[model samples]
Target: MATSVKSLSNKESKLIMAHMYVAFTALFVGATCGLLQTLERSGKFTLPAGIGYYQILTVHGVVLGLVLTTFFILGFMLAAQSKTTGGLNKTERTVAWIGFWLMLVGTLAAATMILLNEATVLFTFYAPLQAHVVFYLGLALVIVGTWFEGFVMFKRHARFRKENPGERTPLLSYMAVITMLMWQIASIGVAVTVLFQMVPWALGWVETIDVLLSRTLFWYFGHPLVYFWLLPAYMMWYAIMPKIIGGKIFSDSLARFTFILLLLFSIPVGFHHQLTEPGIDPFWKFIQVILTMVVVIPSMMTAFSMFATFEARGRELGAKGLFGWLKKMPWKDARFLAPFIGMLFFIPGGAGGIINASNQMNQVVHNTIWVTGHFHLTVASAVMLTFFGITYWLVPSITGRTFTKTMNKLGILQTILWTVGMLIMSTAMHWQGLLGGPRRSAYSEYVGNADTAAWGSYQIAQAVGGSILFLGMIVMIIIFVNLAFFAPKGKEEFPIAVVSNKAALPPKVFENWKLWIGVTLALILFAYTIPLIDIIQSAPPGAKGFKFW
Candidate 1:
């Protein structure tokens, strides 16, 4: 019983619009900082010493990586839940609005500190670099807000199950719940680090902090944070892409299975991010690396399923040849092209992920520009592109408008610009990384040094790519503005792909969220317990915080 576009209540529409507004505004601010960083690194532009490169970097990462992704995903999920599951009840809606405002206020507070140069610690906010107490407090509030929203979603889904005991949860709603569940579990590591470690240290309640312990906890939350960005994009791929392309989901059961596996495996693999770090046991790191490798299985399954669906649709559309089906796709549709281009970038991005997760390979590229390249490809290109694609129709749907022809054409161009920019920037970054270019540093110092001269050219390329990306972002914002405010009023359909009739529903076990949650916790404990204990036991004397900026 999907809710029609016209059926949306004013409250739901306003809430959804608020979420999107914050998300897009963050995107604009973050992308501007990103462009400045790229140019600054290339020695093409320089900021005053009062506003250091690291400060801008911190703002960029927080706004884009943490704030934008968090707000957008929650908003998107709320929209999906409303459309598919009869909208949130009054209590849930009230709570959701509260959460949104808390997150927004916290974001503003944090951004103020960053802009004031009081909090130069990067998004990881790794220890030894202490920020203003307000920064940590703001981040804590954001996380708490998200938790409140996650609770509402979980309760809503529980009520749905109670009402329809034997039926499987709707695919979109099911994925949304799994995503939030994994986030709640995965966020615990960072939450503990912030609430107990960083907050005390920042407030001067503690003289020094345990650097290793803090980092260990951060990565514990950090790696799964990738999945938090990714699963939402995957939801669109699995549940909505098929409909846009005139096909049903390949298998609803398999989609649910993939999400379940993600919940189980995503958290335990956090240690893979620590492969090159000391203090943690190499053996435990090895175990986590294997676990990280195992998580790839579900992504591979998704790839196969999506390709099969695309192929079937292509054949039905009368396309011939092995690769001709790609041509048969709705190439002119910005919604499809944006995400499809993102998928193309992910082919390399995912491969880079495998490389980064490898014990041997990670040593070569740890903390290098290659790691940046990989994440940009996945999170920036893949995840953000999909988010942009969703905005194409999502804005119009909530506003009771349709995209202008000019806006749709601009959307397509924006995607192309983004794709091209990412390829250029990421390729340059990868090559420069292999040549020993360090990440998270102002590299302009080496511009003319003969020893590091090779990196200069790539830096220039990166700047060019970044400029193009900024352009694309501006265009995207323009398109959204037009659709949201000025476009002619018309009906815009919500596209929720159907499950193929031939595909049988999974066993009831697949829908047993309680069972899967328990197994997921067990796996996380098995993977993290020993290493975390060892780190706590062997931690060196605490570090007195520094404010380098």
Candidate 2:
């Protein structure tokens, strides 16, 4: 008898590839829109044939920020869970496919509206700036699809726990469950605003909408949406990065603890995003700001754990001095190098986040291009680069293809181009913001005002940087194509870190979903209940929708 290698079933592979295809398609289209936005913003190019600046901006933000991230994260979670928990059952697989199709249909509907220039509301889709009713309906469908996916994941994990009582849950699958739980809970805010508020108002069933309330509800989902993008990257960092670098996990219990902390802290801090808006009580804003700062502790814990993992592994290999271990890392491997660079970007990105969250400092940068630069550093660079790194091995593994050396070299070059481009673009945006450059507006001379005049050079620099980033994106798409179809037929490893023997086992409390969920709900209510009531009670009359596009 011949020994058999463990792998995802052919059915599972096809399901996973469906997601990959959609995600990469979104990447190409979104990146092209981004490049066009920068060129138009520079005042050097006009959007030909009535293609509006806000139109491309809307496509860029929605496609990349919402569509690509959601598809890739859910797909990656499914793959990880399947591998770690002995694969999804037939029902689970069927449910996953259903979810995928729903999301795809939703994406197509929304994209059609955008291309028709019927909805240029940007990614935030804030109120008083109404989109087509179909757009809101499409977005609702996307969220519903994600919920279905989350449901199956929860079911699969529950089945595994029942089948093998007393055994520790697999790390990747546990993390996936936690991520989906957070998603299920946090997404309710967006769904509520869309279903009840935006959809009704857009359909003209209501003459006016309460702008403040809609915005409040949105930021409720918006800030956590940041973490929704982040935790998956953290999963790769904590659970997968170690194996790529020839080491075991630093501490499984610590990883679980950090994730729990993220869950507890992520949802209630949206008020920090609303620091400038009036009507919310200052005391409540202050409270949320404190909570936001508290959330930083887990991030620092993650940073500490990463450093410890690297040091211990380096020491094991008999590296000499304090920094000698850095030399021991696999610098040439794109799988390791790409996400490692992402870690470096987060140092500045996280600092900028703290600045934005602070009640006092927020007054300095609020609504400025600095806010745009901050997220570009975060979601665009750190999270995006990490996702690309995951693709290096993941696409090949699912397709039963080898990650060849030529492709690896191309990936590293792509990472370098991305880093340089983002550095230039984000730096210029930050500096210009401090000089009072506005965000979300197209090129304007402001009647030759001196202040506006100062932003011109920076805009030019943005165009340059944006063009380079577009090139990098093309390179990434090429890598994706090779991995999916043309790479040699061989099995690539799905790297999952083993827990260190010296690490303590996680306490059962970590798995207590009810306890965590209860605390999360309490925090959200405590943070928002009073203020929400005040907003509703002492409200201005609602405003009618506007269509600037």
Candidate 3:
């Protein structure tokens, strides 16, 4: 899309608007799925035990995890890349509309297939239950829609770089390119499945395929896909965390490196998902585990650095005592309230995630609610929370409307409910998992084992907990809907353009090769996983296997 260097481009506005609509839509679907799951567990909802619930779960995951994220990030990068963006011409505007509509159609079609029992495979496509041809075809188109963004962003950056030769690229643009690269690579597996594997199978040309091969390919893409979901949230954190907490970012250099680190480490670490799966082996597991653990290094550095930045700002603001900086912080504006609560939710989730990422501890928690809890802590608590907050912060620029101050406050309140509710729900599931209630089951019907009855109360607790989560989701959707269609247009205190009012930096750092090389080396270890799992799953009970990382 051609954008003038003088004003905000149509692509950016569309992306922002699309982001809002998709984000709200996802919240709506995910919340509904959550309600059903809760109802099923409560033994209260009178729904049939069939494809509808499973498909709801499936669509919820696909929509929230894949569909909504792609649109949001694509829009964000496109909008952010223009050095001088003017309003789009009709052709460019039409492209934006096509991309958005393609994504929507794909999401809806995929949802329909999953709902109708045509695709019984879990959202992860854990293995074998194939969906209708339309499902994979629809999904392929969604990915294609996003690829259009790559074309637009690259051209825009090229134009900007040409005009400003020898200037370092902005960190935001650098991350955006890497995200595109990562997404392209990540999409290969899914693309192959759709175009080569699943599509043919659904067409009845192929009789069967390798389940292990397909599942392994899925994880290779799947785990990295989570980071794809996370990068935008991370960008927000690195960019906004300090501003919200009353500090400057500890180091722009560190944020740049962290983005690079994400690219380097995230792609190769997918094998860690296969540590217990049949497709991968022990050596690969060891290698993957090492990389997976190493990933924490940069991540921890980020946490420490962000905290230091907070302290620096706090001291400058005349705050005193160990945690007194938090006291002086503004607690009312949704922009501020959302992230504070998001960070509050992250500490425990990060801790639990460490357990899942561990080599040995994973055996205890794998395929159980512990794994579920760990992710809920990350996704529900951290990623989704930040997304919601940022949307609140960005709403005015995109919609030209201000949400009700009370509803905005209520949104903050919903975050509170979700925080407490997820804590209770996930903790209950974690405890139940230790008792061995299997994951991915329609219901946790533990038979006759002492551990089964032991977890009953915990399962019941989740019913209550999930109900609270659903309520929170309802409140959130209401808030977003009101803002989108009903909120009065107000003078935006900080328009989207003003959001990045800091002095312009050159855009040369984007071409840095060091970051690319580092990521490549770190990911090499992923190759070892499949061999490792095959060896270990066969070992007798109480046996340990050797490995090479």
Candidate 4:
């Protein structure tokens, strides 16, 4: 029966292939737009206001970051976890395909309108400055498509639990589930916007929707969505690479804890995004501030747990010194080591991240390059680097083909170039932000007496940094494209693979929702407690005339 199931699984590889095709296009579009944005900012390429540069930017962020990636992750998780967490069958597969097509159509519809300049919401789609109704409708369809994929994941998890009643989940499968749960809970913001605002507006039902209310709604979805992009990247760090390096996980339970923490704390921390917005009460700010701090707990724990894992693994492998793990860790093992280095960068990134997510600090730095630096530190460092590594690392497994060693090394080198360059770039960006540089503008054409010349200096640095980032990205392109065209064909077997798709034990019906529920409760407790206190103290909106010791 297991062999038959295994044989049937080969049929599903096409789904992953389809997803890869879509993903590559999305990545291409996304990267291209990013390059354009960089060029426009440089003393290089400038787009006239009437030229719809912001339109392209919207398509870029939405297509690459949201649509393409969302569908790709959905497809990847659907296949990767199906057999491992519990095997999904043909019906679920069909559902996923339906989801994919819906999203594709939605993307095309929205992209067309955006290009035509009918949809100018600029990715965040802040309301009042309404986009074409089709834009909102298209977005709704995209989320609906995502919901299909989410539903399929739940169905598969259910089957796995029922069939395998007494075993623990495979690590990859476990993480997939955590991501799905996070998506389920975190998507409320966008979902609400579509239902209450976009749908009505699109159908000519409403004249104006409150932009702040919509932005808040999106944050409810948006902040956690950042983690959705991130967790998969981290999953690769925790699950796949260590095995390639011949190391045991330092702590599996802690990894689980990190996912749980992100699930609850991530979205609730969204109020920090609203620190600059109006109509929010002081109580809301206080609650957001506290949740922002609570967010640190899990990230810090992950830092400790992941570092401990690496150190233990390094030590066991005969690494030495106070931080010899840094030096002695296997840099040559492309799959194993690249992600380890990437995780090291996340430490400062996470700290800066917490500050960006803080009420007070974000007020000082929000909308500045500080904000840009924070995310570049994250997506460029964590998501893009790790995902590139995973492309090199996982493609062989997924394709059942042998990748060229030279190409693998090229990919690794690219990741390093990007990581190091981005570190410098984001650092400069963070500093400039501290110096009052604005972000998300076409250019710092207005420096407001803040050494506008320094803006020129930093822009030069960013230009250099952007070049480095592109070099790495080009290497990434070469490696993935090469693997797609030249990697050897035929199914490769997992070295010591499990025979079935069912995740071990605790079927969906019997599953414990309490763990995640408890996590949400804890997050709410930590997130809202201070806001509750603010209600009592009646703090003012400006945060003015208040000093903390």
- Please list all clashing residue pairs in model 4, or write none if there are none: 83-501, 85-503, 86-501, 86-502, 87-501, 161-507
Give me the overall lDDT of model 2.
0.90
The reply for model 1, stretches above 4 Å from the true place, is 1-7, 445-453, 541-549
Return whichever of 2 and 4 wins on TM-score: 2
Per-residue alpha-carbon lDDT of candidate 3 for residues 1-549, written as tens digits (9 for 90 to 100) = 221121244355655677567767777777778767756765556456653657676766777777666766666565545423333345555676677777788888887888777876667865367788998888888877766666555555555566678765555565666677677777776776567667777787766655655665676678778778777777667666666654555666666677777777776666677667753556666776777777787778778766776676777888899997776676776666776677767788777767877878878888876777777777777877877777664555455566568777887787788877887888887887777766766575664354655556777788888888888888887777776666676533322211232434423453655657555654544453445366445544423232111
Which tens-of-lDDT digit does each residue in 1-549 have in candidate 2?
A: 322222588899888889999999999999999999889988999988999999999999999999999999999999999999999889999999999999999999999999999889999999778899999999999999999999989998998999999889999888888888888888898898898888888888787776887888888899988988998899999999999989999999999999999999999988999998998999999999999999899999999999888888898888879888899999999999999999999999999999999988889889888899999999999999999999999999888887899999999999999999999999988887776778787854432233555667789888899999999999999999999988888878999999999999999999999999999999999999999888877676554222211
Scored by lDDT, model 1 comes in at 0.87
Error of 4 at 381 (Å): 2.1
Better of 2 and 4 by lDDT: 2
lDDT of all predictions, in order shown?
A: 0.87, 0.90, 0.67, 0.69
**Models sorted by TM-score, best on top:** 2, 1, 4, 3
The parts of candidate 3 lying over 4 Å away from their true place are 1-11, 48-52, 82-96, 245-247, 447-454, 493-510, 513-549
The window of 10 residues in a row where model 1 has the poorest summed lDDT is 540-549
* Candidate 4: Cα lDDT at 17: 63
Alpha-carbon TM-score of each model against the true structure: 0.96, 0.96, 0.86, 0.87
Candidate 4 lDDT by residue in tens digits, 1-549: 111112115556667667777776787777667766666677666775566667777877788768766866775576668646646688988898888888888888888888889887777877555777788778878888888888887777767767887666665676777788788777866887777766676666544555555566688788888888888876766665555555556566666667767777776777777777755676777777777677778777767756766677678778887787766565775565556667766777788887886666777798888878887777667776666666664555555565566876786687678877797688878988887887766665646666777777787777678777777767777777766666665443332122112223333422365767676757756664554344324434422111111
